[model samples]
Target: MTTIMSSALGFASNRRRRAILALLVVEALSLAVISALHLSGVIHGGTRPYNPEAAGIAEAVIGVVLIAGAVAVLSSPKHGRAAAQAATGFAIAGFIVGLTFTIIGGQPVDVAYHAIVLPLLILTLVLSLPKPRDLGVGRDQGPVSKSQ
Candidate 1:
């Protein structure tokens, strides 16, 4: 069981995976922390009432997706790539949702934090994504070599 857990988590050792993990972690943490702050009255007042519990639930799903994507990429690149893509989408969506909240008169701190966090998420997602060349789909191949 210990070995199995290690195997599942082994991908995080790779530098690329680690970078992605950092971004996901920070995004999740920001939501969780801000939610706590909202509940605690450190941040209050918005068009939409701050719902920390709801935010926590969303963060939990994002966290699961993040961990699963990282682990899946290790065992199967095909599935892992898809998972990573989905994870990237989720990250970006979360950032956009943060912006939407601000637009709707949410807390100023939410916008300020999103300003800092969104760039990190974007950078990591950009790095994790497959380049067209990686899929043998970029640039001119010059000539196709025929083994036949």
Candidate 2:
């Protein structure tokens, strides 16, 4: 019974991790589109970034980072967990700031984009957060003691 329950929990965790990866991919793609629009002089908004070129460059870099994070999340379990956490946290911060700026000083299009993306980023972060370890999930030992 315990084994079955543990397997179920493990499956759920894997599903959640995959969800996080999918969200990250979506975010990366969205950032790429935003970057392209800004760089192409298609989206000129009244906001903190007076220079659309610089903002667009930054967005492109962020998108690249997000793509890297998605790749990392598909790696080993420990590494993937860390990558997911970092990626989601960074995206959440960026989106929140963008949302605030858009709401205060930018166009409605910008506002709507930020508003929609921020919550999804938050959800990704939440899902990426580590949970308590399951008993006998993988190895019998958690980690070796340094003093040992």
Candidate 3:
């Protein structure tokens, strides 16, 4: 019975980890598209002047970071949880910053989109913070633990 329970828990944890990884991938892709759209003038916002080159550069940087973060989370046996949580937190912060700036600049549509993204990012962030023990995985006291 104990073995069965442990196996079940491990499976659940793996699923959760995969879910977080998927979220990161989605977020990265979205950022890439957004940057492309802004650069291509498909999405217009007065708050942030559109600069295709700059947007592309920014998108590339964000993509690299997000991908790296996702890889870190997916690969680390013990610190995966923390890596995912930190990635989520970073995403939340980015959304908040973008939203706040857009609102201050009086871009209604941009603000609305940011508001939506912010909540979703927060939700993912919360999910990422769950302890490994909570998922029936062994306790990990790494320096990068998101619970800290």
Best by TM-score: 2
Per-residue accuracy of model 2 over 1-148 as CA lDDT, tens digit each: 2221232233236677678889989999998998899889898857664455665786787788788888987775556766777777777776665666666666677777777877887888777664434434335766656786
User: 1-148, model 3: which lDDT tens digit per residue?
Assistant: 1221232223236666677788788878877876676667776646444333454455556666677768876777366666666677666666665655566653455556566656766766776765545545543644445665
Q: Of the candidates numbered 1 and 3, which has the greater TM-score value?
A: 3
What TM-score against the true fold does each predicted structure earn?
A: 0.63, 0.74, 0.67
CA lDDT, every prediction? 0.60, 0.71, 0.61
Which tens-of-lDDT digit does each residue in 1-148 have in candidate 1? 1211122223223565556656655666665676666656666666764444455455456656666666666556435545666786786786687577665676667778778877876786776665544444434665445762
For each of the candidates, the C-alpha root-mean-square deviation to the true structure, in angstroms, is 7.1, 6.1, 6.8
What does the lDDT come to for candidate 3? 0.61
In lDDT terms, which candidate is top? Answer: 2
- Candidates ranked by TM-score, best first? 2, 3, 1
